[model samples]
Target: MYKHILLASDGSENAVRAAKEAVKIASCTQDSVIDVIYVVDFDKSKSDVLHSGSSEAIDIERRKKNSKVIQFLNDANVNYKTTILHGKPGPEIVKYANDKKVDLVIIGSRGLNALQEMVLGSVSHKVMKRVNCPALIVK
Candidate 1:
């Protein structure tokens, strides 16, 4: 029933799981499409600049990080497109979901400790709170 599904990925193990879930959901409908989002936060950008040899290398490394998610989607033979956004992960994901008016959002959970989550506020928590649509958090 959901025609537009948004998936937020960080290239983590949980994110790969989320990709699989997205594929499953998208497959439920004939016209469903999965929109994968990967955010490049300022901290990561800074670190990449500092450590990488060139911008081309940074781009390559970023793609490497997202390879698993892409691979899963491709192997599943699903209709999906990955968009790279530059900003805080939570806010960027929320913004995209809102602007696109997606029917559902699937994101990976990092499973942070209580104290760590309370302090840092996991991105999944933030997106779930702010997004208008139903959100599925994959652990």
Candidate 2:
């Protein structure tokens, strides 16, 4: 019975899987509300800017990336709101989950940046370790 669920998404395949899991879990309780967060990685944002040519373009691309998850929740009748945050994904998601006092945090095991995850670590790993609530990392 998780009343407050936080889903950290990066629009990757695994993220869609996580979104599915979030919907299933959130549906378990009538009062559940999901907080979807798409954190724009600072380093990746620079690359996106260079490829996109403008901030507005970048925003559009971001929305397009996350649209599937949003649409899925809508079709499933799950109550959720998405917030876009600009920062390092791991820290940003952790801060948001803790600050919002969510009861559950769900995220994909991997993200859009596979090389970065191999080089440094995964955003899901960081979130699972730091969140104040139960963290569900979907593979």
Candidate 3:
């Protein structure tokens, strides 16, 4: 029933599982499109660290994170597109979902930012509170 599925990943195991689940859900409809998003949350210190690094280093990190979801989508042969954006993960994801008018948002409960997560809770929780669509969070 989902026309557009948004899968948010950060190269985490939980995110990979979420991606796989999104793929399974999309498999039911040939016309469904899967959009994978990896947000570089500027609110986190981890992002500050990435910013301090060289541009090549930053691209390498982004590529590494994107690869996890990309590999799964490739193997599944799902019609999909990937996006890498910089912003606070929760709001950025919610905004993208709203802009795309996605039917479902699939995201991991935990991401790469452990310290900020403990202080502010997970991005998935924030996304759930913000997004208008159905959100499936994989722990």
Candidate 4:
């Protein structure tokens, strides 16, 4: 029943798996289009002057991740538009979905334990709280 699906991929294995599943569902639906988003979390660089090396390293890594997401779509033969947003991941994803009027969101959950998740708040959880559209969180 989904007409416009928004899939968030961060180049992680879990995200790749979620993308494949989302694609399969879109294929079944026949007329649906997938919108891919990769959020570049710039918040990690706030105090970057003290850690310039780490900041630069993270920027490079983010670029590589973005490239991987694009490559994955190309390999799958999926025609999709992509966005590289600078901000916190959750807000950016939710905002993009709302802005695009997407009917559904497919996001990957790495299934981190409570302690790990507390230390690094889960993007899926934050996006779920903010977005009104139905979200399918793939573990």
Model 2 — which ten-residue stretch has the worst lDDT?
109-118
Model 2 lDDT tens row, 18-104: 999999999889989999999887788668978987889988989999988888888989899989998989999999889989999
Model 3, position 9: C-alpha lDDT score: 83
Give lDDT tens digits, candidate 4, residues 1-139.
8878899988888888788878887877767878888886686556544555676676666668667656777787765777667788889999998988899999999889999999998999888888989998998
User: Which stretches of model 3 miss by more than 4 angstroms?
Assistant: 43-60, 111-118
- Scored by lDDT, model 1 comes in at 0.92
Show how many residue pairs clash in every candidate, following the order shown.
0, 0, 0, 0
Identify the runs in model 4 with alpha carbons over 4 angstroms from their true place. 44-63
Candidate 1 regions exceeding 4 Å error are 50-54
- Pick by TM-score: which candidate is best? 1
Clashing pairs in 2: none
lDDT of 1 by residue, 1-139 (tens): 8999999999988999999888888998998989989999987878889999998998889989999999888889999988889999999999999999999999999999999999999999999999999999998
Task: Return the candidate ranking by TM-score, descending.
Answer: 1, 2, 3, 4
Model 4 local distance difference test score: 0.81
TM-score of 3: 0.81
